[model samples]
Target: MELDDVDWKLLDLLQHDGRMTFTELAKRVSLSAPATTERVRRLEQAGIVTGYAAVVDPQRLGLPIEAIVRVKVRSLDTPRFRERVVALALVRDADHVTGDDCWLLRVVCRSMVELERFVEQAQRYGDTTTSLVFSSHVRNRPLTRAVVEGTAVD
Candidate 1:
């Protein structure tokens, strides 16, 4: 689905506030509620809007610990090596990168005990280290005036 100005505007609004009601989205995009709903529906169908999620504070959830684990897998070409690493729920994100380590996993758990268990399960063929994350600064998607004006974010 080719996105026009309306679609981009909807995305911009939703990016900032995914909880916005369809009626509110309609007003923001200068479209009728039904039209806005249709556009959003199409966007969802086309996979542009994957899904909505509530961004909760890990501290509030009792899972205050956050860390990035560098996993050095012994079996790089093994069939289930990647699969085994990704199966755990604590692993919020995973990526394969070039370097000494084969992959990296971002995990959040309530305590060191939980983290140790998670690590033991995740490290199917690698050594792991759990670092304490004092803080994190995650940048939100830049869907502001710059994107609207098509100046950057290219």
Candidate 2:
């Protein structure tokens, strides 16, 4: 879809505050509420706007320990690993990527013991390397036009 300046502005505003009402969005974009709503609908139809979600802090939720696990699954275990990994509640995010590791997982646990158990279970499928996360400088940063267009200036 060809997004104009208005569409880009809408995306930025929505990303920052998904709960912002259509009327408020219309005011910010200088468009009528109906027009703004229609544009947003089109964006959704085009699959540009996937879905809205609430961001929560794992630390505040009693999940203080965060870790990244790299797993090199055995050739024959890939299918089983994929299914089991998806069922694990400790895994916050998982990515199948290239390199020495076949899968990268972001996980959170209440304690080191819990993390160890998870790692041990993962080791059943393949070799696992885990790293505890001390800090995260960036989480979910909003996307903007310049960034997407490769015209962003540092």
Candidate 3:
């Protein structure tokens, strides 16, 4: 789908504030309320604007520590290992990457004790290194320009 400037602006605004009303969104992006509503609907129909969500503060809600775990699998060719990684709940994200580490994970945990337990469960997956994230320099945002350009993101 070819997205124009208004579409891009809509995406940009929505990413920051997902609950913005159609009227307010229209004013911000300089579009009529009806037009903005229609565009958003189209974006949804095309699966561009797939879904809306509430952003939760992990820390404020009790989950404080964020762990970056680097995992080096014994065999990348092993399908079982891949399956295990995917099925693990503590594994927020699992990627087969370069260098010594075959997979990297970004996991959220309540405390260091929980993080240690997560690591222990992952011990069978080869070697693991865990790092705690104290804070983020930039909050998680969205792909504003890509929505406008109608291009795939990397």
- Using lDDT as the measure, the top candidate is 2
Q: Name the 10 consecutive residues with the lowest summed lDDT in model 1.
A: 139-148
TM-score attained by model 2: 0.96
lDDT of 2 by residue, 34-104 (tens): 99999999999999999999999999999999999999999899889988874699899999989999999
Give the C-alpha lDDT of model 3. 0.81
lDDT of candidate 1 at residue 39, scale 0 to 100:
94
Error of 2 at 119 (Å): 0.4
Clashing pairs in 2: none
Give the Cα RMSD of candidate 1. 3.1
Judged by lDDT relative to the true structure, which candidate is superior, 1 or 2?
2
TM-score of each: 0.79, 0.96, 0.80
What overall lDDT goes with each candidate model? 0.80, 0.94, 0.81
Give the TM-score ranking, best first. 2, 3, 1
What is candidate 3's lDDT per residue for 32-138, written digit by digit as tens? 99999999999999998889888777778788889888877788434776676556766667787989888788888887898888787666768889888777787
Ranking by lDDT: 2, 3, 1
The reply for model 3, stretches above 4 Å from the true place, is 76-85, 146-154
